[model samples]
Target: MDEFAFVDRSKTNAEKYVLRQKLFGTEEVMPLWVADMDIATPECVLEAITKRLAHPIVGYEIMSDSAYEAQIEWFATHHDFVMKREWLSYSPSVVASIGCAIRAFSDAEDEVIVMDPVYPPFYSQVRENNRTLVIHTLNQDEEGIYRFDLDRLSTQTSEKTKVLLLCSPHNPVGRVWSYEELSALCRWCEERGIVIISDEIHCDLVYAPHKHISTARIIPENTVMLLGPGKTFNMAGFSISTVCIPSQLLRDKFEIERKRVHWGDGAVLSHIGFEAAYREGRGWYYKLIAHLSQNAEYIDKTLSSTPIQYAKPEATYLAWLDCRALGMDDRELRKFFVKEARLGLSPGLSFGKEGSGFMRLNFAVTSQTLTEALEKLRGALQGDAYV
Candidate 1:
């Protein structure tokens, strides 16, 4: 419990807190906008970075094979997925990999399909790359479960569409795609000759009964998986992630573009932290899931009768809140949370038009912090909250 307890980041220059005034126009609100955890990074990762400072030299260094091997073992043990070293390569972050893959596999004006209400970068990468953006809208069922419409997406596809950016155990709205859903999507993409760029950064943050299926595991040759330890270990500051391309032909194409862009191996300290995290952070990770799960439940129970509607995510620390019930527009909804609730959350409309009238709360903070945020919401709602 001590490990997961609140360690104040107010003085750490954490972006979530530092940018609160700029983003929300207030420094008094609880800054929960960013995806990184409020909990400390895994001790093993920190210790490894500290130990690496023993070396006087901090020159350019290639990542070690043991780091890749550690990740392979972790995935095999946890996700039942086996990966070959030959298929793996280094990337600074998943978003960079997406842009690289876009340039490698598609030409200007070629189409890329991105889901609505996804991580905003998925949309930006496509547009900024000069590719035609095809938005695939995801719908929520009566029970509040978000689902993709394959038939509709299939109809939306064009011959010029060369890539599909997938988010497994999706962000904002956390749905861990079932094996069957992944298989079907993979088969469809493969049939239409669309290469899938899957961002699985949140794979390890999933909750109980909802398993994160790596898109590469379903059809590796047709998939490019963006995997990293950043989200799992709360080590995004390290800025380390990798690209897993299983096909030689795809890797050749990617390598050519990668060289053109000069995307070299990452920092020395980051490499050490990456390997250590996958190698020794298992016990800490499961405990994090338990902690996050309890936080999710707390949000669920607290907001059940409030004006805002929430369905506990099957995976991810994100709480996708439906604020349409408050009868406020997107801008008003944002202001309400900032001025009334004294909390800062991500405005759903920033994700996509489909995300209108929603708010995404990061529930990865300590229970005390979460309780305070919820109480603030309840107090703001006042007479509106149902007993």
Candidate 2:
């Protein structure tokens, strides 16, 4: 496979590429802030969508049983997770499912505990629903690896706490929660009657020597697992995801909430694309991982001698860069990157207070693009012209 199959996404209404001026106050900087990749969507996915387009009329369509089966088989084969056909529910997006779960399972003013410095939506969904947003900050060791602050998490939980939104193979920090850590978290949540909404969107993007354990595999009865191909297959435009609920009672409540919002079924093309990506995307998926791993290695090797410090991510293409060594506050760090480096990156403070002095870089671009970005960064740091 040509790992450098770069697709110019500019002028196509791509949120990452087209919204630079609105998002970062300039269109000159490289856009690497969004989670999607700069690589082309797999041929298999495009082919599937093309096949579906052959139909004369694109009308209201229901999700096929085969779509659910494809997802079930993929999870069972890849993650050792056995999902029942009945356990699957269609969601427009993971965050949408999370919002529905929040409304269905908890009442207004109830508390929902989110691991701080998490995906930003975890914060917004809780507050938007009129629920009490309780943040339990994650702890980092001296080595810069992030870990669940289970001790503090336990202290934060109470009868008012109704949900725990978990990010496995977490975003930005990129810590694939270990099985032991997950087991402990499951026990803690189960004991307190807390429902766990585990977002495993990046489960398949894991690197070697660090495995991703599905939270549902450990504690299915108490967990609502959100799995999707958006991150793995770069299909976020499809706006389709699956919610796996093991307990029938919880599924029932979620269904009611979903209906309350009049969330209809997915588009016909999305269904075709979803099933094809899961069924025929394994080969492309592995090759993409290899490319990403190489990109990550390049970043690690290049940054080793610099003042910038980063914890090499075990999963996801996102790298968390610790810039405190540069002695810049969060604002200065952002300004330095945008002005000096001409690189657009996600500011660490957006994740949480703990993320201050850090930045998240998405490396899922062509090797040439990544090298150029890194060279620009290196030049800025060394007070030389960026090439």
- The global C-alpha lDDT for each of the candidates, from Candidate 1 onward, is 0.91, 0.90
Q: Please give, for residues 291-374, the per-residue lDDT of candidate 2 as tens digits.
A: 999999999999998998876789999989989999998889999998899999999999988899999999999999998899
What TM-score against the true fold does each predicted structure earn? 0.97, 0.98
Q: Residue 24 error for model 1, in Å?
A: 0.7
lDDT tens string, model 1, 280-351?
Answer: 999999899889999998898999888788888888889999999999999888988888888899999988
Query: Whole-model lDDT, candidate 2?
Result: 0.90
> Which stretches of candidate 2 lie above 4 Å from their native place?
none
Worst 10 residues of 2 by lDDT: 1-10
